[model samples]
Target: MAGRHWPGAEPLLPRLSRSANHGVLWFGAAACIATFGGSARARRAALRGVASLAVASATINTVGKGAVRRERPVLDAVPVIRRLKQQPFTTSFPSGHAASAAAFATGVALESKRWGAVVAPVAAAVIASRVYTGVHYPSDVLAGAALGAGAAFALRGVVPTRGQLPAPGRPPTEAPVLPTGQGLVLVVNRESGSATAASALIRDALPLAELVECASADLSGALEDAAERCVALGVCGGDGTINRAAAVAAAHGLPLAVFPGGTLNHFAYDLGIETVRDTAVALASGSAVRVDLGRIRPGPEGPDGPDGCFVNAFSLGVYPELVRTREHWAPRIGGWPAGVLAAFEALRGKSPLEAELQGRRRRLWLVFVGNGMFQRMGPMPGRRHNLADGLLDVRVVHGGRTPGLRLLAAAVAGPLTRSPVHAAVRRRRVRLSGLAPGTPYAYDGEVARSGTELMIDKLPEALTVYCPMTAA
Candidate 1:
């Protein structure tokens, strides 16, 4: 627009060339990305801070440029300011420079008040420089300044009333446990795993309600028998071990609780139930927040595999390797650090598989079709980023150089979202095939046999899991 109106006017290029103005914009973007890297609360705060800047920048640029649509130097309009050129056209209502500077200030504020104070002046100076550069009229800059200040002022900070920092350094105690009581049914995974862990979880959770154990081969029957009594069905095992339990719970409209005892409890972890203790507490007192679950057709498991609903995620491709790695190695190392290391060792020799996105074929080493967000990790796009959101965050990994190692590398360094080879595009339904039985596949963090063909779809708000007050 500026180029068109001010065909001959002082072009925006000369002003943009100066280090101070454009430099600040780059700095602001970096600041936002960095701020978002902090823990959950801080990231949301950072985003809130940037909101005003975005609004102000857009408004200033529009208003100032529109107001000034000044004719360029080459045009016939009398040039009060040096006509960089008569604007090829006219009227500049909002000053983009001013808007850009103001938006930059808003981003700076998210860092801290002190930094906010420093950036504010720099932004103002940048706006003033636009006028001195002769690309903008004084009025243009003044309007930009007004827009910028309004934005800076608007983005004070977002304060969550209830979750506000308690005493400066202390984590707020869990919300006063309400008289939270629900009819819980315990279902154990009699599959091949440390029965002790599931047993311990079952025993610990027994005080909560009814208990029953079902053999992996007959999980469906066991679940059907126990579903009637459960208001919340607590499953004890790896994700697959409890798949039937979840199916029953969903069928009966009951909330489900998980005891993550498997080697790779990705679904459990994604559910924010990383530890036995976390899941236990959630079972005991957490508030239920409804979330989406996915149902896989032509079941990912074997022939006897009961038609099931998954609470965490479902996938094909390199998912098997991830499950195997997490299962085999996580136990030895313990917790996240160990789980990650285990993944590294597992990926060392795996081959990536080829797949397609909307029919465009590509090679994928790891694919995680996810339902929930990993705390501290930003949202998995296209899905509400909420477990309760009825859509799935289907992720596709174009396993790079060393497929396995890439998984391990990305895990420690960061997710592979930006990896040149890693790409994710959302879909309502996905068909996965070309893998044999005994080959790995996962649904809710449990490894199931990948077979002839697998179809996965978002179950749409099918779960009711406990959540913190704020999360609710």
Candidate 2:
């Protein structure tokens, strides 16, 4: 194994790391300080520059990780692995830490040619940390370095080669448009599920897949109607449409996919596919890996107990409000602005209800349970909260007013699970109560079923995913 059997970080960070793995992090850290650290003032400047590069690397990597959840070697069934450190919560995709270090070293090198010699060696050393620590494959480290350097150099466009820092709070620019193929089938959302918008996306994505416009007059007919074709199902709507599309695809065994055309394309990001172009190309070019899906049964919805199926995160409370808000605004503007409008729209609704999940009783303001992954920050890069994992990341929220205002603060800024304002709760199964009939509940992004009770459970390894850039 090129990657080593190293000691863990909690123990390693403080001590002279023992052998088992020696070359990477030890030398990497040493090189970083030695090459970058100079006279007191010069070293301070280098440290600042390095830190900036690291932050930039982490941000871009995080988004890409969410957008490209490459599976880790940990997923392999064989026993060639021995974890030397605490396993990261993330999968190994475009290594964030390494990329950041590489970018930092690269940036510092650009500042001085003499520094360049030292910087390149140190950057290479840092790349060694991941593989040497046994947390990443050799390939993982290399890709991370490449991405980090790219992001660092890219930031220069915003910050300038020698001056002016980049603007804060600027979301990543729209995904660069790509020339797509000429075959596409557009799914339209006439009902709240976004069949109509999907049709528009298909109009635009015609070069990608063959388009067939499908819509449910309402939530009830969408799944049955959309499942007719077995080709890859690409949804251009929100969680609801994705749910309906996924349910239809799950039953039909057709590959299900997504475009961020809806309220939140949690499934798309989890799969590491972004933009219609990203989705179109990935579906056309990527291979299929087995993945899990979530199924739900409603106590008394208009549909057969199964409210729907989900390939991404699902939740209650605020999530439903989030969807409802978007539904109200989709006709006006179809992107993040609709989400922003929806946040304010939710403020017109009710407060968190007291409820019981699986047997635990608690008062909550909101609850979030996801299938793919969850990051208030768009996609959680490097980790797929795999629907196939069979476990839902359940979160319970309470004590926040949905109608009070502050859209961003109310949307992702708050965690239903942890907050003095809310009770952080996690469970495998849940029974909800203390709400009115027709109280909106969300599964993926399907329209809220006006039901009083819901029955939910985790189904493991339910779906297969195609990961092209995957590594050990």
Candidate 3:
């Protein structure tokens, strides 16, 4: 192939070969995909692409190249213009460039087929360039590409993609089918992240539906007002805003439609609703499901406390403090930067909370309670496969001197029954007592003060939510 010159290959192949050195070409492609690809799915594809590239590069440099000592192909037959100016000095049994290209392309494809198609041609060009530049043999490129694809599959096995996970376990429920979204009223929190753009998209998709945009302070009233006037209650905002909407919808006995307009729409994403179109389609088709709503109430023999519900998770510890700090700075700066700053500020002088958990007195740094059983996908606690599983996913990080180090270890350890620093359990309800007055806790990104005692439990199949039945 190198000896026989192909038309339009002389100038492009050598430059492509040089550009792919040290995986620069693939990294650039990943960056572009992340920035311009538009959706969360695209961002995930870009992340997976770079992660696969890293794995393939590491394997090729540390193991593949060392396992075989084959030298580079001689440049005698290759044309001068097609050859790379800086000849590779490493063994050529497996082409590192080919490996990186194939891994990135395969990883992206695994997440999103459309993006994979866009990247496939560039990857193929890089692979061809490896051989055209007289740096690797045809067999070497083939072997490397195969190894790279294998690495992507291997990584997926360990950390399954969103499509690979089981669908949310809520049972199908009856809903009013408004094909043009006539009977639905959506409340959009203009202060929430991306709410303005998402509101526009929702408006376009559901032309007949009524939309009410309001500030954060008026979100609850807006949701309640929308629920009173419509057959179905729809909300577009962050988790906290959605939590408020959920309570109103439940009270009004209306099916809820959720549009992901928040910085992180954990509940909406867990229900397989990523874009406004997802909820729109569900509303049009009357496709809906009943999911569990977690509640925190005043425990027995305690002072009267405010009752609240969370669509996602509830936590008491440094995490609540982090949320408080993040909220304080989030309005001044941006969400991501504020979160980073808040983490440092929240943990600096924080101490553990002493409370009686399930009648057992324990010193704890963090207490996390998920509405349903949460699974570990990769390094983090990911989505819930069953939203109505009737179990509280309880995880506790033991109090220690170094709150930062203990939290890091807990995150790294994933879910465990009992570790030295952390423990996890599943229960229908968990009680907490003997707490210091006005202990701060967070539910669905909203921080609040807790009373002396609290009872956390799940309401089985409580809220009917609109979600596309065909979604993965």
Prediction-by-prediction clash tally: 46, 55, 0
Query: Model 3 — which ten-residue stretch has the worst lDDT?
Result: 374-383
Model 3 segments more than 4 A misplaced: 3-11, 299-306, 377-380
Which is the better candidate, 2 or 3, if ranked by TM-score? 3
Candidate 2, residues 283-306, lDDT tens digits: the string is 445444556666566665433544
lDDT of 1 by residue, 42-98 (tens): 333345445655667566545545655564322234344433332323345456567
Task: Name the best candidate (by lDDT).
Answer: 3
| Higher-lDDT candidate of 1 and 3 | 3
lDDT for 255 in candidate 3 is: 93
Residue-wise C-alpha lDDT for candidate 3, range 21-133, written one tens digit per residue? 88888889989998777568888999999999999999999999999999888889987877777788899989889999999999999999999999999999999988877
Query: For each candidate, what is the lDDT?
Result: 0.55, 0.52, 0.87
TM-score against truth, every candidate: 0.49, 0.51, 0.93
How does model 3 fare in lDDT? 0.87
TM-score of 3: 0.93
